[model samples]
Target: MSRVRIFGIGSSSGDDQAGWLTIDALLAAGLQCDDAMVIEKLDRPGANLIPLLDNTAWVILVDAMQGSGPAGRIQRFDQKDWPRYTKGLSTHGFGVIDALSLARELGRLPSRIDLYRIEIGSANPGEQAGDDIQAAAQQLARCIAADLIATLLQA
Candidate 1:
């Protein structure tokens, strides 16, 4: 079984792509799948995200969030904090929180889940993420990498 599974969820629009960019940042920084961990980028997966949670011991979700704070500010949320942070985290009609709720209802949720929300300045179509958002993504990737390393060491 995978020790950890990280999913970067987002769309092609500007800042909304924060999640995907974070995933890219991780890859660029030399993080890769091994027996202990796996990473994937999901394009607005919505309800589709539920099945992907199965059997992972730990899960990390990365996504863009707006109105939560200043652009480029990153916030971390665990499963218990989802309801309070639901706003502006979704670029799709159905979002990460929705998927998690469904997973919980179905008893498919992992024992542990960590969500990283990258505050976005704009999610305009056909545009790339702003500099601040990109920097946040890179920063978040480093943080997650460190957390994973720590977890692996403990294991």
Candidate 2:
């Protein structure tokens, strides 16, 4: 099995900009089910992210966020520091951060996790996230993938 993994959750909100950009970035980077993944919602990102933790050493969650940043700004949240940065309302009932916090509170959280969020212009664009932000999200995706791959290769 591929060791590197990514779970991308974009909202059906924010004009869908973050969601589109995240999916585009993953596609542009050529990440796949075996090496990486781009998901639209965290609560239902399927079984892809959950099971991997059993055999993998790391997991990266990438998505879009509103408030406290400029467009195209990239943000990183470490597992330990996620709480301070992740308290807010998400269109997707309980966002990845919320779900994670729940898992952690219940003592079922992953041993290692990383979160990378790209500040988007907005989430709509119904069809796609436009050009510039899509590229930016893709950039974030590559960085996320590289980080995972690096960790695995090192081990």
Candidate 3:
């Protein structure tokens, strides 16, 4: 059972690749995952994400969004904040919130779930992520690393 799990969710698109970038930055920053930690990169996971959390105690999910925010802007939210932010908007065909709701209903959600979304202006497939989006992903990686460190310290 992994105590801490970080999942980067998105496809290989321009802004959609923000999640992948964040995880790549973290790994590049020498993030050492002991047995208790697991880092995964998910592409268009949709409802399949539920099974991935079966053994995870804490979850940090990062993804890109085409919502009402400036491109490159990063938004952080806990599970409780999901209803407020995720309406019917997402760069992917199936939004993250949809999976969250399913997980909640199926009782597969972890106790501590943190969601990070990077606002994207565009996410055309095959295009590389913009500088601003990459910068935001790096920033988000720092924030997530800090949070994970704090959690580890508490335990």
CA-only RMSD, every prediction: 1.2, 3.8, 1.2
lDDT of 2 by residue, 11-94 (tens): 555434554556556666675564433233343343344554444445666666665666677778887678755653343545
Candidate 3: tens digits of C-alpha lDDT, residues 1-155:
99988989888988899999999999998886788988879998988888987878999899888887788999888777898657526876667888988999999999988898888878888899999999999999999898888878988
For residues 102-148, could you state the per-residue lDDT of candidate 1 as single tens digits?
99999999998999898888899999999999999999999999988
Question: What's the number of clashes in each of the models?
Answer: 0, 8, 0
1 or 2: which has the higher lDDT? Answer: 1
Q: Where is model 1 poorest over a 10-residue stretch in terms of lDDT?
A: 83-92
What is the TM-score of each predicted model, taking all chains together?
Answer: 0.95, 0.72, 0.95
Lowest summed lDDT across 10 adjacent residues in model 2 is found at: 38-47
Candidate 1 residue pairs in clash (backbone atoms < 3 Å): none
> Superposing every Cα of model 2 onto the true structure, what RMSD results?
3.8
Model 2 earns a TM-score of 0.72
